[model samples]
Target: MAQRSPLDLPEGDPFGPDNLPYGVFTTSDAPHLRKIGVRYGAHVLDAGAAAATAASPHAELLGASSLNPLMAAGRPVWQAVRAELRDWLTNPAHRHAIEPLMHPLTTLALHLPIEVADYVDFFASEHHASNAGKIFRPDGDALTPNWKHMPIGYHGRAGTVLVSGSPIVRPHGQRLPPAEAPASPAPASAAPTPAAPSPSASSAPPRPVFGPSLRLDFEAEVAFVVGAPSPLNTPLPLAGFHDHVFGVCLLNDWSARDIQSWEYRPLGPFLGKSFATSLAAWITPLDALAAARTAPPARDVPPLPYLDDAAAEPGGFDLRIEVAVNGHTVSRPPFSAMYWTAAQQLAHLTVNGASLRTGDVFASGTVSGPRPDELGCLLELTWGGRDPLHLPHGTRTFLEDGDEVTLTAWAPGPDGVRIGMGEVTGHVVPAAS
Candidate 1:
């Protein structure tokens, strides 16, 4: 766990800070996927090939080829492989085991971390809730009647989730303002001016306009990868939630804010959330992050019995998370302030026996806090951009076309080597003309 030197990295640094996560990769010249690999520096230490030669319990998971077989083998196998991999890569002289299959991370391409079975996005951050409340009901309350009762979430479309680096096409949808107040005719006593046609009658058709949204937005969050499958009616104890999660990744839940505000009242986010979502390619194993876990803040009201985990650990990861527009890091503060924890959400998810499968994604919602600078999204950081945020490139209330958003996170640990989650980025394309 000590910080590795740059030389260790160049010798195919398997323990590089940003490369702590794992994912399948294939080089352009490789025929038919045949190995598993972990990102380190700019190289991938081919896990599959290394296991073939190394004497480790993980050899079975790395058998012959593609990572899909290993990934589907579930959590126990993943943990075994992670342990073996860390040992093989960290020892300076282990190249005899890893040399032949090694390749630069840049030359290879990342694949979808998993074949996601389902996706659920949770609104578990209190700061995010309060900020939204200020916009929707500024005059009254922050927490809703049902908010403190349980974590609120919506099932998301898994088919639409894409890996980092994929281009996001602008989504087209209907947009409209509230109906205008009716106009009144001039008073007879005023000797009315020439009569005018009714404004409403002369307006354009009311059908949905087809063009990319003008108010596209992004939600920065942490996602849990479900490793173990569950039965349809079994409830998982709050403390046991960790057993089912494989690892974690950074995610950007893209949104069409304008459309969301208009349509969410009836049932909640649909198209606004359905278009696209991008996730960090590498997945940081949960075991590696377990050492960094810290306690979350207490809720004012007592949680429902099933929702409470009396034995739950008091801390979450101490990761420093940030967002960058195009390539410029935003002025907002880091991610230490999130009010909700992923464990609580997962525990509640199966309270009724809802089956969970490997590859299911659960997002932490937008992480924000009391500090104005720590706000997670433009809607909060800018107070609706009533005040624009200054960036090295300029200032922005929200994203603009050709703009790219990137998210990165890291935590300091033993030695000089810090574990990190690589960047997840996406660019804004112009709306259809």
Candidate 2:
């Protein structure tokens, strides 16, 4: 009896013919040479080789070392290439030519799929933002004034965006000391007490001290990859989202909560967030997730005309995400719970005439839901460290050296199948001296 083919996957495999995510990989025999590959069940097909074997017109695009060139080719080309690849895999006539190009996934080393141009992260989840505001400012409003009016985002350091499995060096930075307790109220002896004098320089609040961050955390997010470039000073509307975006992937936006808390006032995130961000190697194409599209949550405030997506296609993805630490599942953030949709984010990002690049990446900030188990990051799960999470290994308020965090997700796919977004994982190492 002959052994079953790797392509003959079990029913309902997340990575089926309906979901052919792309990535870059290398083999031990030629570690220096990188090639674009498409995942198929337990194997990765050398896409370029298969295209070359089939004498495909898009062979050059498929054969590139990086996904940038193909992604820059625009939407029509993307659809055509995807159609051809699917036909080659599903059609028995091309199986003989394609099967030889399939390589075992375990034997390959995956790499960053694209050359990142610019990275932006958005605070898109209402639950997450509310939780954060409540944790950091107990006496203030949970959501900011302009939060519902538009998508709040900040530019991130693209150079630090790394592929999954990379080691994260805990960042070093200044952190404010714990707040001093209020002095007991003086006895009500005087009818009217004079106001205390303003604090002098010598009596100023405690100064920040430099050290390794004590509150390391991970934010589970989903990100979109840009495909086509746009002209400078031209705005892309919400309807143009699919025209420019190529695919989606899982993202782990690593953060130093202590460093952020000390420096985030007045200005937004700086060194605390610029250290490291992990991206999954596999990028599931937008076309593969057609079944996952769903209506976004109803907005409490009416959106501005430019960001309005009321008449657009369902702008939210029904992705179910799982966040784990050291092999223990902790949170299950639902992508569908995000208050702001990806289309709205794209429109808001380009509304000011900012251009789009082929490899530009923008992530949905910390996907979280209303349930206790649905929080995306340690900052919320541990409730600002007041409540420690009791994992099987031990209790944890935040990440420790050698701790590994992984994020994985799946969306509904065509014909009741599931579309896998793969996973982004990183291990924390001690900070540098």
Candidate 3:
């Protein structure tokens, strides 16, 4: 009896022919050389070598060490390459030629697929926003006044975006001191307590002390990668979303909450958010997620003409996400529950004539649902530390130095199959002295 081929994936395999997510990898023999790889079951297909062996015209694009060259070739090229790849894997005649190019996943070292040009993270989940407001500002309204009108986002540090499996060094910054407790009243029978020293007029305002962050957190998010570049002063409309976006990847925007609270006053996030961001190695193309598309939640407030997506195709993806800490499943947040769609976020991002560049990443911030167990971040899960999450190992309010956080998701595929979005994971380490 002949052994079964690796390409003959068993039924229900998430990385089947239908889900050929792309990545960059290096083999052990030649560690310095990187090649574009496609995930097929438990193996990584050497896409560049396969393209060359088939005498394909897109060989140069596939041969590049990074995905930027292929991505910048635009949608038509992207579609053509994807179709060709599917044919190569499915056609029996090419099996012998392709089988030799496949390598076991364990033997490859994966790297960040794209050269990140810019990054923008948005506050798009109503449930997450509401929970955060209730925890931090109990006396104020849960939702911000402008949240319903448009997607609120901030520019992030592109240089710090990291590949999955990278160690996260705890960041250091200023944090406000814990509030002082009032002195106990003296008993009437005892000597009166000496008068407490009063603050002088020249006393400086409360100074923030510097140290390692006490509130380290992880945000489970889904991000889209841009494929084509737009000219300066040209805004990408909502309809052009598919034309520019190449695919989606899981992202962990590691945050220092205490630092954020101290410095995010009038100017928004600075050192708190700029430290590091982790991204999955694989990128599932948008074309493969056709079955996952669904209508976004109905809007309470109508959007402006440019941002309006009422008549457009369904923009929300029905991806189900699971977050795990130390291998224990902690939360299952649904991506479909997001109030704002990625299309709307992209439109709003470029509404002011900002151009779209290839490799730009925009993430849907902290996907949380309406249930207690569906919260996305520790800030919400622990409710500002008033509540603690109990696990087999111990209880946790925020991340510790050795904790590992992993995020994984799957979207509905054709004929009841599931499309897996490979995980983004990071292990925390002590702050550098």
Candidate 1, residues 201-257, lDDT tens digits: the string is 668544445456656777788888887788889888777766788888888888876
CA lDDT of 240 in candidate 3? 90
The predicted structure with the larger lDDT, 1 or 3, is: 3
Q: For residue 276, what is the lDDT in candidate 2?
A: 98
**TM-score against truth, every candidate:** 0.86, 0.95, 0.94
Regions more than 4 Å wrong, model 2 = 178-202
TM-score of 1: 0.86
Model 1: residues >4 Å from true position, as ranges? 1-7, 10-19, 31-35, 55-57, 63-74, 178-208, 331-334, 392-394, 415-417
Off by over 4 Å in 3: 180-204
lDDT tens digits, residue span 305-373, model 3: 988899999999999999999999999999999999999999998989899889999999889999988
**Tens digit per residue, CA lDDT, model 2, 86-167:** 8988888987788889999999999999999999999899998888767654666777677889888899999999999999
Candidate 3 residue pairs in clash (backbone atoms < 3 Å) = none
